[model samples]
Target chain A: MSEILKMAWRNIWRNRRRTLITASSVLFAVFFAIVMRSMQLGTYSNMTANVVGAYTGYAQVQAQGYWDDKTLDNSLDWTPQAEQAVLAHPRVVGLVPRFDSFALAASDSSSKGVGVVGVLPATEDSMSRLSDKLLEGRLPAPTAAEVLVAERLAVFLKIGLGDTLALIGMGYQGISAVGEYPVVGIVRLPSPQLNASLVYTSLENAQELFAAEGRLTSVVLTLDDPDFAEPTCAELAASLPEGLVALPWQELMPELVQQIESDQASGFLILGILYVIVGFGIFGTLLMMLAERRREMGVMMAVGMGRRALATMVGAEMVLLGTLGTLAGMAAAFPMVLYLHHNPILLEGEMAQAMLNLGVEPIVPFALEPGFFVWQGLLVAALVAVASLHPLLSILKLNVINALRA
Target chain B: MNVIEIENLSKEYQTPAAKVRAVDGVSLRFERGEFAAIVGPSGSGKTTLLNLLGGLDQATAGSIRIAGTDLASLRPGQLIDFRKDNIGFVFQSYNLIPVLTALENVEFVMQLQGRPKAERRARAVELLEAVGLGERLDSRPGQLSGGQQQRVAVARALASKPQFVLADEPTANLDSRSALTLLEIMERLNREEGATFIFSTHDPRVVAKARRVIWLEDGKVVSDKTQEPTI
Candidate 1:
């Protein structure tokens, strides 16, 4: 076996140019797979961070029917004990309770329907970083009749800072609700749909105006690890009071999940095509090598080498080539991918603006996790192994007399 | 004692035009330590006969016994093993493995036979030295001259210490000087090691060196005779 291996090693170098070219094919395959897959996953990761971090915290807890009906009638009771019960779980790092309802707002001659959300200013700022998004003024004060209107909403109502805006809506139990509040700030919400008609005010003021004190439409939980969101949601669902259910961000924002999955399927299609191309390249090399050495193989067999032994030598040659190329590719790609992971490519001009309008960051990041590196390496190795089978079977079925004559 | 016995050996090839019998109704026997040559024109079955005797090809309708073991009775794998242990082959093209050094080429068959590393290495060196390639042990076939490569092939054939060595047009590709040198070395090895040798050739130089010669015409032996070797 050692002699066979030594011969195989020497044989590959007999045609150094061919060996290197074949190996480079595998190298390019692994390099492209790693880089392409990293960029795709990294983009999705950034999008999820933006959407979940800015809007739906990693998971949410709401009254069982609140997500479906979304009315004051289905609001969950928000007491000190309820807050403590949620915060006691180790995975739940922070909780922000929100009283959400719809109302009609008007400033002079302009009127539009809007989603009115009341939040504890400090917790909302910590979870959603709402203050960072403020285009003007400050957060609405807890006890004052102040509000932050979304940028688009502010434009539609033609309302500016310190200007009073009138709101009217149905409160809990079908009671009539009305309020007049000063616009404290204009916040830029990333999502175009949310930016169009959303308003923010203090929980105390919203409950007072809606006549639903101590009731919150949902409690968004900031988790320590987003990857564990599903398990945490399961535990929260089981432990929370009756009529409350925990929902992971996937359920809260299914459109984002579907988008990632759909994009990922297309990415795999492209990757599969790349592998097929590399597979053919490797197979072509094997075919040429076999054709060139047919007579030498016949001589070896006539001198007493078995068919299986000859095949094993060729197999070893292919595997060695695969390993050499895979390692070289990884060595070349990892540093580049890691660099991109840290220093993402930021977009500019119209592309950046288009992404921002859709609430997505325009930077492209690469993921440097070792899982993908190892996976791409193994995939190329499998392709090489599969390509080598042709040579093995050809040798096994060889006609030594014909080969000798050739 | 007979090392090889054959009776009515025949081989047929089905070509598009017709079925051609390459070796037909040929009976031959070889004794231990004999240097014999089969001489025939092109298409007269000299190579086909050598191939059958070396177990490199199967006879269509005949029996071949090497050292009392019937060739027809051995399975394919067993025949391959038998060839490995008992028959050595030298080709017309000096078909030494191009990647291997001359010494490693010689050691290859012994290694396949699972000989100990030390024993095979020592034997390979001895054979290469006996073939007058003592100074070229590390030379790959590509680096060697035609005569040197054929010498390496001869050493490799004898590396397993097989019962006999079969040479199929072994000197056909060599110039007169290289061919004569190769024949001399083979003759000296056959005498010194008592290794039986059989050659299939149209080369009169090879016929001159053989102690016994057989002539084939149209796949049948036309004449057989024993004579004093010219060498």
Candidate 2:
């Protein structure tokens, strides 16, 4: 085997130009696949983390039919028991009970429909990262009948901190309710869709305005490990009483998950085509090499080399070429992909607005998982191995006399 | 004992137009340690006979026995083993692997037989020195002259110490002086090493150096002669 390997190594270097050409194809294919996959995975992770962390946390628990109806009638009663049940889970780092209802809010001469989320100020501060997105003023005090409106919503209503706003909407018992509250803060959400129609208030003020003294829409749980969210959610669902459901981020934002999965599939398809091109490039080079060495093969056979040994030597040559190309490509691509993973690329202009409208954050980040790297390397190696089969089969049935004549 | 025996060996190649018989019903025997030459004009079946005897081309009829084993009766793998163990071949064009150095080319056969590195290296060096190519051992085939390349081929042929070495017009590509030198080296190795040497050639210089000569015309051995050394 060592003798065969030495001969194979020599054969590769003998035709320096051909070997380099073959290697370059493998290198370029692997590099392109790694970089493209990294970018796609990065964008997906960034969108999920930023969107979920900024607002929904990793998981949410709502009344079983709340997501489907979203009406005040389906609202879960906000009780101490529900909060305790959610907080008992090991993965639940923080829990916030929210009373969410829609209202027609107006400031002096301007009016708009908005989603009002009534949250416990201190609990929300610890559970969601919304407090950090505040552009002006502060969160309402625990006992104050004050509200926090998104910047875009505030601008549309022409209201500021300390200004009075009227909330007019249907409350529990199918009755219209009206109340007046002061705007305590204005905040900007990462997504434009959220920023344009969201409003926040203290849980007490929400209960008073909606005439629902102890009712709640859902309890949102922030988990320590987002990747285990599905299993944690399943456990929560099992532990909870009937009429309640635990939802992971993926289930909550199914459009986002489907979009990412489709993008990943398309990315791999493109990479597969690139690998086929690389395979053919290597095949062409090996074919030319075999053609040139026909006489040499004949001589080796005449001197007692078996056809199998000759084919084995050629296969070894391809393996060496493939290994070098893959290593070089990985060495060059790993650092670039890792850099992108750490320092995300921010989207701006119309693209940024479009992404924000779709509930995705403006920045795209990469994931530097070892699985992606290993997959790319194996793809290159497999392509080379497949390409080598052509020459190996040809040599197996080679005729020494005809080869010599040629 | 006869080193090589042939009985009614014939080979036919199929063409699009007609069937061509390269060798037809030829019977011959060569004694151990004999330096014999098969002389023929172009297309006279000299190379075909050599190919059949070396187990390189299968004969269409009859059988060939070398060193008491029938070549026609062996399987594909067994034929390869037989060639590796018993037969060595030199070519007219000095078909050395272009990528290999002179020494590596010479050591190739022994490597095929799984010989140890040190032993193969020592034997390769000795053979190269014997062929007067000691100074060119490290040079690739492309770097050597025609005659030097042929000497490397000769050394490679003899490296495995086979019972018989077949030379198919081994000096056809060399100038007269280089041809004489190559023939002299082969003749000396045949005498000193007691290795049987067989040549298929149209070259008179090679024919003159043979201890026995077989002449072929139209795929049949027409004349057989044994020459006495004048010296």
Candidate 3:
């Protein structure tokens, strides 16, 4: 067996140029696969981090079934002890206590239905980067009777900074939730849905207006990694009160999961097509060697070499090729992919806006995990092994006399 | 004692034109330490007969017994092993494995016969030196001259210490001088090692060196003559 392996090794180098060509085919395959897969996964990473990171904060702790029928009446009983206990988990970085409900806002010129979010300004700033998204005017002071209106909503009501707007909504139970609040700032929201109908105010101000103090619609927690959200959320929920539930970003935003799944399906389809081409390329080289070396095969067989041994030698040759190519490709591609992972290519102008609209960073970040190299290497090795079967069968069925004459 | 015994051996091939009987019914026997030659025309079955005797091809009819073992009694894998242990082949093209050094080419059959590495290595070196390729043990086939490669093939053929060596027009591609040198080495090995040798050749130089000659015309032996070999 070792003799066969040694022969196989020497056999490939007997035709150095041809062997190099065959190995190069696998090399390019693995290299391109790594690059393509990395970019695709990187874009998904950016998308997940952007959409879930900035706003939803990976996971959310809300009243049970609140996501289905969101209203001020179905709010979590907020207590400092409960909040602190939930935030004590190692994975949890911070929490933003929020009061979210719908309210009708009216100015002298117009009236519109808006999503009114009541938040601790500093807590909201840490979680969703609300302050960074301010288009004009200062963030409203905590406990101040001030409002931050979405730019589009402010435009619809023709309300500018310092303009007083009347807000009316049904508060907890059947109470009339109405107040006249001054719009202190205009802010921009990334999503069109949010930009058109969002309003922000201090938690203290919202509780007084709704006649419900020390209460929260939900508590959105930010974690070290969005991917950890589900497991963390699971443990957090089990440890929390009976009426509350924790929702991971995947559950909180199923559309994003669907989008990622669809994209991955398409990516794999493309990679499958590439592997077919590479497999055939390796097989073609084998065919050429077989065609040219029919007599050599016969000679070996005639000199007491068995069909199985010859076939194994050929198979070993291919394995050697795949091994060489995989190593070379990975060695060549790793640093480049790693560089791109760190210093990503940032898209701009309409492309940047388009990416932003999809809730992902404009920069393309590659997923440079070790699995990328390992799986790609395995795939190419599998292709080489499968491709070797063609020649193996041919050799096994070889007619010694015919092969000799040929 | 007879090392090889054959009775009515035949091989038929179905070409597009018609069935061609390449080796017809013939009976022959060969003994140990004998250097024999089968001389025939292009269409005759000299090469085919050699292939059959070496277990490389199947005979259409009849049977061959070599060193008391029936050819038909062995399975495919066993036949391969039997061939490795009993029959050595030297082809017309000096078909040394281009990838292996001359020593490796010689050692290969012994290795297949499961000889110990050190034993095979020592035997391979001795045989290579006997064939006059002692200084070229590390040279691959591509680096050797035609005669040197053929010498390596001869060394390889004897490496297994087989019951007999079969040479199919082994001197066909060599120049007269290389052919004479190759035949001298083969003849010396046959005499000193008591190794039986059988050759299929049209080369008169080879035919002249054989101690016995069989003439075949159109796949049937017309004459079998024993003569004293002239050194």
Candidate 4:
């Protein structure tokens, strides 16, 4: 076996130019695959951070029909027992209980419909970092009769700090939910959809206004690790009280998941085409190699070398080529990705504007997921193996007498 | 005792035009330690006959019993092993593995036979010395001259200690001097090692040195005779 391997190694280098060209195809395939996949995943990562991380928590516990209806009647009952049941899971580190409803906000002559979210000030700050996004004044106190209006909503209403804002809507069980309060702060939100008509107040004020005391529209959970969100949500939902479902952000924001999936599918299609091209390149090189070495192979077999052994030697050569290209590609791609990940490439012009409109940052960061390295390497190796089958078939079907004559 | 017994050997090829018989029915026998040459004209089936005897080609209709083992009865893998153990071949082109050095090429067959490394190396060295290539042990086939490459091929063929060695027009590609040198080495090895040697050749010089010569014309044996070899 060692002798065979030695021969195989020497055989590949017999035609140095051809070997390098074939190996180069695999190298570039892996390199482009890694870089492209990293960029795409990084962009998706940024979007996930902006949307799921900042707006929706990793997972949420809500009444079964709440996501579909989002009405006050679909809200869950908030009690010590319910909160304890949610917090019992180890992954669930913190929860921000919210009373979410739509209402008409009017400042003097101006009026607009808005999403009113009543949150526990401290927990909401911890999970959503709402205080970090405060554009003016401060967050509303838990018992204060003041509200925080989104920057865009404040602009639309022509309202500012200490301005009187009136809210009117149907409350729980057909009661007229109406209140007026001072706007204490203006908050900037990342999502344009969320920023357009958002009003935040203390949970107590919301429950009081709605006449639905001790009720919550949802409790957004902050997890220790966001990657485990789906499994944790599944476990939480299985154990939660009837009529309540724990939902991961994927389910909470399915359009984002669908978009990522479609983009990923397209990315894989490009990668598949790349492998096919590289496969043919390798096959072409092997075909030439085999055609030139036909008589040598015949002589070897005529002198007692088995077809199986010759095939193994050829197989080993291709494996070496694949490994060489994969390693070199990873070596070339890793540090580049690492540098870009640390210092992301910021977008400009229409690309930046497009990103901003999508509520995402205008920078692209490479994802250094080890899976990218392993998967790309294995894929190229498998491609090399698949390409080798053509030559192996030729060898198996070789006619020693004819080859020797050739 | 007969080392190779062929009874009614025949080989045919189907062309787009018609069935062409490359080797018509021919019966022959070869004894151990004999220096024999199968002489024929072009397309007279000399090479095909050698290929069939070496297990490199299958006969259309025949039974070839080498050392009492019927060649037709072995499976493909078994035939390969049988060839590894029993047959050695030298092609006219000095078809040494270009990647291997002279010494490594000689050791290659023994390695396939799963001989110990030390023994394979030692025997390869001895064979190279016997073939007067002891000094060029490390030289690759490309680095060697035409005469030197055939010497390496001869050394490689004898390295396996096979029942017989088959040389197909071994002198065809060499100049007269190189051919004469290669024939001298082969004749000496046949005499000293008692290794059976069979050649398919049109060279009269090869026929002159053969202890026995079998002549073929149009795929049929015209004559078989044992004669005293010329020095």
lDDT of 1 by residue, B104-168 (tens): 89999998899999999999999999989899999989899998999999998888998999999
Question: How much does each candidate deviate at the interface, measured as C-alpha RMSD after superposition?
Answer: 0.8, 1.1, 1.0, 0.8
Candidate 1, residues A1-406, lDDT tens digits: the string is 7878888898888899999998898898888889999999999988998888788888999999888888899998866766777888899998888999999999997999999999988889987788999999999986677899999999988999989999899999898889999999999998888898999999988998899988889999989898888899888776787778889999898999999999999999999998999899989989998999999998888888899999999999888888888998899898999899999999999998887887888899887789998898789878988888878899999877878888
Task: Assess candidate 2 and give its lDDT.
Answer: 0.87
| DockQ class, candidate 2 | medium
Residues A1-406 of candidate 3: C-alpha lDDT, one tens digit per residue: 9999999898888789988988888888889899999999898888877777777768889888899988776888967667776888889887888888888999999999988888899889877788888988877798898999988898899999889999999888779999998888998877767888988999988888887788889888878776788899888876887788889899988999999999999999999998999899999989988998899998888778899988989899889988998899899889999999999998989999887777566798888889989999889888988888878899999988889999
lDDT of 1: 0.90
**Which stretches in model 4 have alpha-carbon errors above 4 Å?**
none
| Candidate 1's iRMSD | 0.8
Query: In model 1, how large is the Cα lDDT of residue A393?
Result: 95
Off by over 4 Å in 2: A72-92, A126-128, A171-178, A207-215, A231-243, A346-348, A356-361, B229-231
Tell how far residue B205 is off in model 1, in angstroms.
1.2
Identify the candidate with maximal TM-score: 4
The segments of candidate 1 whose C-alpha lies over 4 angstroms from its true place after superposition are A78-91, A142-145, A234-242
Enumerate residue pairs that collide in model 3: none
